[model samples]
Target: MAKRIVIEHCSGCDKHSWGTKHDEAKYSSLAMNIASDIEGEASVRNIKLEVEINPPLDRKRFVPKKSESLQHVYFDKEKKKDIRYPRLGAFEIHYVEGTSVAKVLFSKIEAHRFPSRHDVTSALERIGLYSPAKDEEEGRYMDGDDTHRSSSERSSHNEDFTAVRMDFLTKYVSPLGYEGEEEVKKMTVGPPRAPTPEPEPEPEPEAKPDEKAEEKAEEKAEEKA
Candidate 1:
C-alpha cells in the first residue's frame, strides 16, 4: 500500500528526517507507518526488525581533543615523536560497518590464529608492521639513554623487523593479489578436513561340525532297520 509522509529539514545537519527534527505530529504518524511497514515486511521475510533511533557512534576518527577511548598514542623513536593510531578493536569495529570486506576478512581470518583484534594486532606487529619497541626494557632504554644505542644496534633491529614484515608480505600477502573467485572461495571455506580412517574388515567365524550330515546317517540307519 502507498503511504504519504513529509520529510522535515534539520538546521543542524541540513538533513531531512522522519525523526527527531520532524514536527511532533508528523513524527508520530511517520513512526507508526514505518513500524507497520517494517512489521509486515519482517513477517513476510520471517525476520525481526530492530529500529534504532539516533544510535550512538561506535568510533569517531577525529575529535576536538584526544581521548583514550577514541585513539591510541604510540611513540615513534626514529621520528622522535608520538603517533596516534586507532585502537585496533575500535578501528575494526568501525571498518566492518557497511563493507563487503568484513565477511571476506572474517572468513579468511577464521581459519587463522587472529581471532581477537589484539591477536590480529600482535600478528601485524610481528610480521605486518615494524613496531618501535620490541620489548619493555628496550622501550624504556630508548626513552632514556638512547644515545648509548650504537648505529649497528639500531640498524640490526630495524633490519630484523623490516625483514620479517617484508618476508611475510612477499611470501603471503603478495601472492593473494592473484587470487580469483575460485581461490577466494576455497580460502573462505576454511581449513581442509583430515582424512577419515577406513573401516576394519570383519573376521570370518570358525567352521562348525557337520551336524546335518550326522543326522542324515542316523535317519538312513533307522530306515534300513
Candidate 2:
C-alpha cells in the first residue's frame, strides 16, 4: 500500500517552515508504524512513503486554516480588542491506503502534554520541528541561566517539544465513524502560574529601658513627696 505523509511546519517567530523531507528516514519509520497500527490484523506490505513540505510564511502570526481548530484565543477586555497571536507551527500527517485516507495533527501548544506515542514525539523532537513560541518561552528563562541551553542545542530534549497529536482518524478518517478510534489527546499550553506570596508580618517595637526607668523614678518621687 502507498502512503503519503504531509508534515506542515507553520510559520513561527523565527519565520521558518520545515517539512518531512528534512528527515525522510524518520518519517518513513513513523509512516510504517502508523500503517501497522491502522491495519491491525490485516497484512501491510510494499508500503511507499511520500513527504510534502510547505514554505514558511512571511508574517509571524496568521489565522489558522479553516479546517484547523483554534486552541486558544486571547481577548483584551479593557482594550475591547483581540490580541493577535503568531501562527503556530504544526505537522499534518496524512496516511492514504488506496481509496482510504487517514490524518493526524501535531499541534504546537504553549505547554504541550506528553504525546501518547513517545516514539512519534521523540522522532519529531530529534529533528528541528518544534514550536517557536515554546522556543521564545524557553529563551526568556534561558537568559542569564547556566542550566538551560539554546533550542537548537536542545533538539534531542523531548521535554522541550510540548506538542499534542490530534488523532483525526476518529472523526475525519474512519469509515466506520468515530466509534472505534481512540479519544483525542489534549495538550496544555503552559505551566500554571505560581500563586502570589503573602506579605510577612511586621516586627513589634521594643520598649526603651530609659523610659521605664524614668517612669519608675517619677512614681517613687511622687510617693515620697
Candidate 3:
C-alpha cells in the first residue's frame, strides 16, 4: 500500500528550444514546513528538494530465445534460487588503469577449451553492450556467424566495463512477475507534524501615580496656614 504520488507539469522550460526530452518530465514545487523555535514557538519555513523519477524500462521488442538455445539459468548460490533467463552467455569485465580482464560463462562450451575474446564480445552484444551502428562505423560488421572487428579496435570504445554485466542482470535477465517473493513493504506520507505552542508573556505592573508626594505638599501648605 503505497501512498499516491502526485506530480505537476512544469511550464518554465517551454521557451528553451531543446525542451524536456521524451524520456523525462520536469516539475517545480514550493514546499513549506512548520518549524519550532527554542521557546517552542511555531513558524512557517520554506524547504527545497529535488526529486527524479525513472519510468519502467520498455521491453516490447524483446524476444526470448528458444529453450534449447538458452544457456543454463543463472543460479544464486547464496540465495539458493535459480534465475531463469533466455540469453545463452553472460560475462563481466573489470578495468584498471587502461587494463582490462574479462570473465565469461557459457553453459554450452563444447567447441573450445576456454572462452575466447571474440566469444566474450559476442555475448556482450547479446546483452545490449555493443551498438551495431557504432560497430559499423569502426569497420566492424556482424554476419550470421561470430565474425566482428578485432578486440583491440573495439575495446577502447567501451569505457565502463562493469555496466555491461549489471545491465544484463538487472535490465534484461532480471525476473518479472514476483511469484513467491516477499510481500512489498507499505509506505505512507501523512500531513506535516504540528509544532508545540508557547504561552504569551505576562504584562508588567502599571506605574502608580505620585499620590504620596502630593499629600506631603498639601500637609506642608496646611501647617503654614
lDDT of 3 by residue, 143-190 (tens): 212235654554334323222333222222223222211121111112
* Superposed Cα deviation of residue 140, candidate 1 (Å): 11
Best by lDDT: 2
| Candidate lDDT values, in order | 0.34, 0.38, 0.31
- Give every collision pair in model 2: 61-86, 61-87, 110-189, 111-188, 111-189
Worst 10 residues of 2 by lDDT: 38-47
lDDT of 2 by residue, 1-225 (tens): 655444443333233334411333333344444444434311122224554444232233433343233322334455555543322433344333444545454432422321134333334334423333654565521211122455565433334222322342322223222232333322323454588999998888986579888999999999999
- Alpha carbon deviation, residue 86, candidate 3 (Å): 25
Model 1: per-residue Cα lDDT over 150-173, one tens digit each: 444543332222222333333333
Clashing residue pairs in candidate 3, if any?
none
Error of 1 at 44 (Å): 53
**Top candidate (TM-score):** 2
**Cα TM-score per model:** 0.19, 0.25, 0.17
In Å, residue 43's CA in model 1 sits off its true spot by 50
